[model samples]
Each structure stands twice: as C-alpha cells, then as structure tokens.
Target: MARSYQDVLAGARERIPEIQVSELAELLESEDAPLVIDVREQDEWDEGHIPDARHVPRGFLESRIAGIADELDAPIVINCAGGARSLLAGVSLDEMGFRNVKSLAGGFSRWKQDGHDYTVPSTLTPDQRARYSRHVRIPEVGEEGQLKLLDSKVLLIGAGGLGSPSAYYLAAAGVGTIGLVDDDVVDASNLQRQIIHSNDRVGALKAESARQTIEGLNPDVSVKVHPFRVDQTNVLELMNEYDLVVDGADNFPTRYLLNDAALMTRTPLVHASILRFEGHASVFHPYEGPCYRCLFPEPPPPDMAPACGEAGVLGVLCGVMGSIQANEAIKMLLGMGDTLAGRLLIYDALSMSFNELRIRRDPECPACSDGAKLEFRDYEAWCAGERGHAEAPVSA
Candidate 1:
C-alpha cells in the first residue's frame, strides 16, 4: 500500500490539511460550497462513494488541476476510501500553493454509509446567444471588462425592482463572483421592470434564477445564490467580502442596515433609489468620505414617500440607473476616475435631464462621527424617528 500521506511525507503534515465529513458538509451548507475531490485510486471509486464528488485519481491530480484553475478560491476537500489518500492529495494540492485545501477525514465510504444527497453531472442546453453579444462588442467594455466581470464578486440584497437592474448590469458586466440574496420567488408582475428575470423564472427562487440568468448571459461569471433576506446579524459578514455595497432597497430598514454595516467595515457604499421617472445615486464611505447619515441624518416617515410599486416607475429607468451604478463600480475597481463621492446624481427620465448635487457633511452625524460612542441600535427604530446624527470628518 502507498503509505498514508502523513506517513509518506512526515514533513507534508506541515503542508497538507485533513478535514472531517461533517466539516466538509457544513462548509457546503454555508454560503459557499467547497469542491469535493475524490483522490482515491480509480479502483476505489468504482465501488460505492459520495455524491457530487469529482474523480481525480491520486496519480494525476497535480497535473490535471490546471483545468480547474478558476475554482481555486473555492474550498477544496479531498477524500479516498478511508482518510489516508485524501491527506496525500491535500499535500500535493497544497505544495502547489492552493490557498484553501483539506482532506476528508472519514472519506467516501463513510459518507456513503451516512447517506448524503449527490448527483452525477448532466448536460444542459446552451444559453441564447444575444444575451451577452452587445456587451462584448462595446469598445470601452471589451473582452477585458468581460473577463474582469467574470472575476468580480458582488452580493445583491433583493430581487425586487431595484435588485432587478443591479442584477442585470452586474451579470452583463461579467463580475467574476456574483451572489444574490433574496427569499421571494419571481412573479409575473415583476416582468414590467425586473428584466434580469423573466416569466419563466416566476415561481422559482429569485436568487436561483438570478444565478441562472447570469450563467445564461455569461457563464464566465460565477454565481452564489443565497435564498434568504439579510438581517443585522448577517449583514456585516456578507458585505465584508465585497468591494462595494449597492443599496437598491425600497425599505429604510435594509438600507440602514447596509449603511451601518458598511461604515463598520469601511466599505464604499453606492446608494440608488428610483421612483416614478426619477433616480438618485451617491457614494458613501465613512472612513474615506462623508456617509449617508452625514447628509440625511434620519429616514423620512414611513408614509411620507410612496414606494415604486405604489408611486409607479418607468421600466427603462432601471436599465439607465443600473448601468450607471455598474459604471461606478468599474471606476472603483480600476482606480482610474472620480466617483460620485460626497455628491448625489439625480436623473429624470421623463425630461431626460440630469442634476448633480453636492451634499454636505454634518458635524453632528451619529453613524460616521466621533461625537459619541452609541451602541449599535436597532435599524427600524433608529430610522423611524427624525433624530439628527453628527459627522466625524469628511475626506475627499
């Protein structure tokens, strides 16, 4: 028998890692799924095994890994009949500089006895061609941006009207990593503006379809679907991994949560709102510039403003606003130009007009200011009242 990886190369223990079946399952159950690697000898895999696992015989793992280079960031779990081969595989993968790699402790036989759901790969129809042709041809957004789009990772909070456009452009832009967080299923009524999804996607989980649409439009981008709405507890952890947070929400509660979480993480926030024929956008980064609270200390009363569903919105307005939002994101990644920093840009589709307004930082802004250390308060309660908050200092 080929020695256990730990015994094969005692020094390899310093390089390779071993993981348990439960741990691997938990990782897959989390926001991200780890790539399950079967490094058992080919003869071992011909017997009963684990589900959704890939075959990479021990002898060939290192050389063949080039084919899956893009998936490096994904968690990797290697397994064999028992646990020995997996440790060896991990050593091989790690010596090659794989960022996150580990071996299944109990291996496939254990998972089989325990009963885990899994399926073999199946073929699917190719997405329609027109989905991404236009974006690919534009000179400014050439293949480079498309590749960058494929490489980028973003998390969108909703699948309603606002999320509709954000999803469309982010998919079109080819961001490498795209995450969708929404609990609702699609509905026929959303077709009027939620263009990223369609009548067919109706009744399906919004995040799931959102991922499908992206793959259909451009398979180059990776999709992570989260079938739940974000709350205060999960907001920080979710948004921390992203470069920017685009708030296209209709409710003040989620918006406030995004703002507060972004401030704590020192993240750049892009706020976009659409109602009737009008749209507004601004960039808020408390650590680098003034924040949303620095400009508007409190949310308007619940009844003061009508939502898009009630107030009405131009369908195409989403395409216009969302494209601009993506443009801002691109600018952020390239470090090339000025952003909507400290200023809000408003657009009126009916009049085809645009206005840029400079928003001032209030020295008394609570969220971004050093006025006083306030305990993190409940979002809805804080936004309901018109209490003023102070600003700390405003940078460019």
Candidate 2:
C-alpha cells in the first residue's frame, strides 16, 4: 500500500525535535545561542529571514554544513519557509550524526506573525568591536559609521608607495572589501616606502603581497587581487565594481586612465601623489567638482616629471600622503565633513606645512563636461612619449 503525503510528514515530525519561535527568540538574546541556518533558496532568503542566520539552502546543506561549522556537538537550528521543510532538515542532520540539531517550530511564518524582527546579519564579532574601539568612540564615526566602513568596497589602483600606506590603514579601519590592482612584484627597493610589502614578499606580485599584510592586520577585510596592470580596456569595468576609486598609481599613464574611468562611471575618485618631500591629495567627484583634467588638463612633460624610482622620494612622505588619501576615502564613504572636492591639498614634509588651492571645473572639459564623450586611449604609449598630446579619440 502506498503512503499518503501527510504520513511521510508525520514520520519526519516524529524523528525531528523542534524549538518554539518564542523560545528561540529568547535563546538568541543569550550568550550560548545556537547557530541558526536558513535552508531557504536565495530569493526567499533575500526577501526576509532571521538576523544573523547563515544561509545554506537545503540542496547544498550536506556538502557545506561542515565547512560552516565543524563541531557536530554544537547546537544547530534549521529554518525554512514554514515548519515542514525545517523538520525534514532536522531529520537529515540527525542522521548525519549531528548531536544537537533542532527545527524551528512554526518556522518563519509564525515568527513574522509574532512581530519578531527580520534583518540581515551585521557579521561583526566581539573582537572587532574591541579592535575598532577608537573609531567607535569618535562622535562622527561612531558605531554606525564603523558599520558603514565594514560594508564599503574601495578599489586601490596600485600597491606601490601611495597604495602601500593607504591599503594598510583602510584595512585596519575595517573597510569590508578592498580591491587591489598591481602587476609589478615586490622589489627590495620598495621596502623604503611600500610599507605593506616586506622582504619576504619580494618577487611576489604586489597585489598578493599587499593581501598578506592586510589579512594579517584584520581578518574581517576581504581583499580582491587584480594581479594585472590597469589599462583602458578593463579600467571602466573594474571601477564599476567598487564604491569608490583611490588612485595610488605612481605614473601618469595609470593616473590618466583611472581619472577617465572614474569620470565616465560617475564614481568618486580620491587622487593623491607623492614626490620627495612634497605630496598632493584631492578628491575628484565627477559632477560635484572638477575632474583631475580640470586642474592639469594634460600630463606634464615626461622630462619635467619622472617616476618616484627615478626622482627619489622621501620615504616617510608616502605615509603622510597615503594616510590623507585614506582619510578622504573614509570621509567620502561616511558622507561626513567637507571633502577635497574642487580643492587641492598640498603637503610639504620639509616645511611641515599644508596649502590648499581652489580648482574650478572646466565646462569644456573632455572627461566630465556635458556632451563630452569618453574614449579609450593607449595610455602606455601616451605616457611613453609616443604621443605629443594627452587626448585620445572618443569611443563610439
């Protein structure tokens, strides 16, 4: 004789022990809260689910559960759309030798009906709270701003001098996602200023070197490595993924490429450069102020401006310049304080003084001006002196 669907569910219910929604709500407030796993699909989870619930859909539960939490004896609670699926999940986990697993009674439906709140997890650990205590104590960057830092994605264009200190502080501040682009490897000569890369990382790709240092500083950060140099072809697409762009590139070619890409994408760009004792920092917001081009209009003659390697930079100057860039980036993400938009901040370490210059947007600017079309250019060739002018053709 064939069994009815209700009979199968009845059998599952007997094998699965459950905890009431009310009881679980109370348990969540305790120190020994069980790991809550949502077994719903992506769409359902996105709609609304319990706060801090680790999502592992039923289909992939068995394969991923151990990776999510290894202690079979640790208390675990599984939930779904309603009570039925959760019961089935409990039975499966029970058979898998999990010692303390329970289904959510009445599931999400009853929990919602009871006026329990639903939220995505903030994912902050107690250690993080203590680690970022200084930032939390600040009136401007209190707990809320700290949370924003943990949610922001910042793209850094290089891992050289400027990128080195900038990436370190940004990671320390708990910027959740940091994307790094650098094709060069860590060279022994870089030790003087590229503080993020150590002697052990010599010959390793700069992006990976930076990753190791940042991961060591704060495990909460996620570092995405682009192990290749930025060019016109992929610059725009790369900038699109980040909330903002930080130009730490050492050369004019990359600087121009990043500037155009940021303007075209309408993304905020924190621009900074360091040379010897003098360093410059500014924010180029596409519409709010002048883009990088509005100030220089074109790269200075190659003879006039040489790479830091050739010209020699004061090692500590990178720290000052990069820290300022990080400060500007944090301000932009938190939307606090007046930014460097339409103004340039120049720092001279020799004199230990700072100067500000006012810049205005050029209505006929090729990058951000109205009706100005963005185009891809051979930046390497342009920077290599193959082209006398800085402008590139417009893309169709």
Candidate 3:
C-alpha cells in the first residue's frame, strides 16, 4: 500500500522526539552537549547556522552519518531550514539503529527567530575550489585544511637541490607565502638537481629563479625572495618572519645556525640532506622533539662530511628527499598526521631500501637543553673545527 506524504510525516513524528529551540540552546552550553548536525544544503549552510554545528546535507546524511557520529547511543540533534526536514532526518537516523536522535523543533528558522547565536563560515572561491579539488576531497585535508594551508607561510633556506622540489610542491599545494633565501646564482652544474631553475635563467640569482617558478606554478602563493646567505646576523629575524622553515642549506654552518635560531624562535624546522645515493630527513619541532644539534652533538670532522657538490649527489635523490621535507612541512601546517618529529628517515636509493632511527631530545643539548642559554655563535669557524666542542663565545 502506498502511503501519502502526510501519512509518512505522521509516522516519522511518532518515531522521533522533538526538542525546542530554547532547550537545545541550553543543552549546547552544558557539559554534555549533543552533536548538532545541520541537514541543510550548501548554500543554506553558508548563509548561517548554529555555532559549532556540523553540516551534513539531507541527501548525504544517511551515507556520511557514521563518519561523523562515533556511537549509536551518542546523543545527536538533527536540524534543517524548517522543522519538517529535521523530523524526517531523525526518523532515518532511528531506522539506521541510532538510539538517541532528536529533531530540532521548528529547526534553524525557529532558532534564528529566537535570537540565538549563529556562525557564517568562510568558503573557497570557484577557482580555488577547482585548483585544489583533489586536496579538498580528502577527509584530512578538506576545505578547512586547504584554507589553513593557504594561510600558512614557509621559508626555504636554500633554493638549490633540496629547496627546488620543496618549494615547487609547496607552491603547488597553495602555501600562501614562500620565502626563498639564497645568494648564489644558478650554475650549469645545479641544473642536475635544481629543477626550479631553467637553462635560460642559468646566471640568475637562485632565490629569484625559484620565486619565478613558484609564482608561475600557483598565483595563490606569494613568493618573497631574500637574495642573501642566511648567517648568524639575520637567521633569527628570518626565522621569526615565517611560521616554519625548510632547511635546504648544503653546509653544516648554516644548518647549525638554523637549528639554534629555530630553538630561540620556537619554530618548527623541516630538515633534509642528500648526498650521492643517500638522503636523510627529519622534523625538528623546537623543544617538542630532538633538534639538529641533538642528533649531531657537533659537526663531523671536515674530512668525514662532504657537500653534495664535492661528493656528487644523484639528481633524483634531491627530489625524493625534498618531497619528503615538503610533506612533513604540510603536515605540520595542517596539524595533521604524525610527522617525523622524533625519528630520522634514511633513504638509500642504491640499496633500494629505507630505514628509520628514533631520535630523542638531548637533556644536555647545547642548543635546546633545559637550562642552556642560547645565542648566536661563530658557526662557520665552529663547523670548521677552528673552535672547541664547547659552545663558542657569542659572536657580535
């Protein structure tokens, strides 16, 4: 027998309980507030809705409810533009084995008429929505996370091997502001690994070349070019200006300088180093995890550690490691999945293997110890073994 629309509504009203707007408002402010789900369309939701309400359109409610609701017995309040839709939504929840579901009496319309608080959420433009459609579809990096990425700023300490891929992917992901620090001009040799630079721009400053590439990749990202080497004099200021730093410096002095400055500024650092067929990457989250100095108490003897130029790095190794650095940086920006904060990732392309080593905060680390005083030092001399292992006297 076919049931009339009025008869269907009557059956739903009998199965679901309705809570008044004032009662729902009071419950929202209590210690045991129920999860408020707004079953309105996208346009309706964008206009305004109850503060802290989760939007699940009526069409998607049945399919997406499980993802939003944790338990069958958990209290849930369903609401829509008017009372009828919410009552129907509650009936569906009841049929789906949800034990504690209630419809909002008179729904959002009544709540608004009663002068309750509401929120107007920020939405993405059509261009951004299309550009980052893949990212927006991810549950971990939905529109909210995409917006967060757009508001984030990242600083790449070098525009060479590691910085090239890191900057490229970060820009592609719509990291709002990217600061490129490099004083060197692109050399013919750099073309092997520095993909951000082109043959036509061989003699151009690396920072400028990277900026051009990044800007060309995404108009949403603002590229700030700092055509100077990062030294003790300006490291802290530069670190302070950005939310996070991607350490692509090829030398130990710059690495140590960045480590100490990062501690002082309490900034997160995404670190990666590549040489030959091997690469190592880690995340130094200020005092939260082990820092660069914590892993390497002192720079290795000059003869033991060599730069990629001298040792000759595989071009693709930079892409692998730099892409890892960018991944770690984006995870940090979005406050998502566990980053490599307390672990070192070693990638050996020659062996076709990867290894991980746990890293812990050093209690007596010179740069990040509990009581150690941090100050800029003669990093170049220190890394050169001209100074002793103890922290050198503060440089002027």
Q: Considering summed lDDT, which 10 consecutive residues are worst modelled in model 2?
A: 387-396
**lDDT: which candidate is best?**
3
Model 3 misplaced regions, further than 4 Å? 62-67, 91-98
Task: Encode model 1's per-residue lDDT on 1-396: one tens digit a residue.
Answer: 777645675665567677767777777778777887777764565554566566667887887677544556567888888777777778778778887887776777677666775443231122412444565345344333444555566777776677777777776666768777888888887788888788877899988887888788766677788787777667778888887776767777677768777888777877888888999988886667778878776777778777787888888888788777777876675454699988899999989999999986667877777773533556666456534431222111
Native-referenced Cα lDDT, model 1: 0.71
TM-score of each: 0.60, 0.69, 0.92
lDDT of 3 by residue, 213-249 (tens): 8888899999999999988778888889899999999
Query: In candidate 1, what residue range of length 10 has the lowest lDDT sum?
Result: 120-129
lDDT of 2: 0.87
RMSD (Å) of each candidate, 1 decimal: 14.1, 14.3, 2.3
- Residue 73 lDDT in candidate 1: 58
The predicted structure with the larger TM-score, 1 or 2, is 2
The RMSD (Cα, Å) of candidate 2 is: 14.3
Query: How should the candidates be ordered by lDDT, best one leading?
Result: 3, 2, 1
In candidate 1, how many Å is residue 345 off? 0.5
